[model samples]
Target: MEWNERIAFVRKAAGLTQEQLGQLLGVTRQAVSKWESAQTVPDAVTIARLCEALHVSADFVLLGKEPEPPDNAGDAPPYALPDTCPCCGRPVSGTICPVCGYTLPTTPPRGPRYAIVASRVSFVNEEDRAAELVKYCGMPESYAKAAVHQMQEYASFFLLRRNLTDSAAQWIAAHLDGSCFSLRIVQDNGEESNDALLTKPKAMELPAPAAPKQGGLGFWGVVGAVIVALLILSFF
Candidate 1:
């Protein structure tokens, strides 16, 4: 590609306007515009700076095999987690892209309320789960509508991350305010469990991790022993 065209394409790929590029380069927007139009060439210094700013090699800036970026990042969420829908951060269920309002795919409902046994949850890969859930979500559920929407949003996120798609990721990113989502995924331990983070659950209960034994009155095993001793003393 011609140098000017390369400059313009890179600018756009980086999602910058000529004006922004100019500010970064400490040049006037008209000068940047002229360079893009092939009316004038920027100095060697500016060319090097542009290459650095664009995260491209000088060669890539001057000449690339493809001549332009494929705009591949357009589809993915701009960022991914502490940045998920504020209303439902990393929601186990959601209908709209909390960030973009892009209607995420959902599982339509069937005759029965749907859920996998926590042990059975891992049986489905993200794609299958997403597909099944989407189909189920499409079903009508008066009470579960909000929960279904949340699930659909989560399914989209799971599938997007499952695949190598950028648009899927970008939907999440755009809402994080130029930041990425921060989250930790835990594997299921073959028990049915509700998302601990959810404010409410449909039917599934949040699995409580086993508690440590404590020497306290409310400790059941300890209380049982105390009751047994009290019974012995009362008999005496």
Candidate 2:
């Protein structure tokens, strides 16, 4: 499906009218209609905003695609970690996933965000979930928190890829309890997803080609060398 189609589907799936979706995206209802109609592509940030609003992975919304979920989603749980996961049913403490060879993290994180039981119950399109997490979960909003967002996004990417290992890749979805970092969240209930939104997700984008090397190749080097020679002659 194209992004436009996905966007339209997501809006409707979230039970948002174009006017509602438009309000969330800070655009007019007619503009939202145009986008759904494919009159123009939404800018990158707009796509990101829409994904958060829908609670679907951004890839699903923008690319009309998702990284495949992981390889062991359907496998029987390994016995070593207990039939049920003490830590979110992600088979661990084994040399390899008997089911699918995915390596567990070197060490799992702990506290509020660590366990599935602690998962936050979020309202659909509820961006306030961010503040709730920061306040309630003891999740620090340092630059490091951005690392966690990357972790979540990677897991989502893995899911879109439809790999069986995708579920294992993420920290258990945050208990839709409340928010910490100003995230946008959605719960279709029809869909099994979590969290809501991130206030500022941290990931690197290519830096605009360093401003195109600025005017005239070798401009600085040649000028510097001539200035150096001029200084030497004056000293002599």
lDDT per prediction?
Answer: 0.42, 0.41
lDDT of 2 at 81: 28
So what's the TM-score on candidate 2?
A: 0.31
Per-residue lDDT of model 1, residues 1-36, tens digit only: 766787888777555677767776678999999998
Task: State which candidate has the highest TM-score.
Answer: 2
Q: Which segments of model 2 are wrong by more than 4 Å?
A: 70-236
| TM-score for each predicted model, relative to the true structure | 0.30, 0.31
List model 2 lDDT by residue over 92-195, tens digit each: 33322222222343234232211121222323432344333332233344522443454344422111101112223231222323232222222112223423
Error of 2 at 203 (Å): 35
Error of 1 at 73 (Å): 14
Error of 1 at 128 (Å): 54
Question: Candidate 2 — what's its lDDT?
Answer: 0.41
Model 1, which residues run further than 4 Å from truth? Answer: 66-236
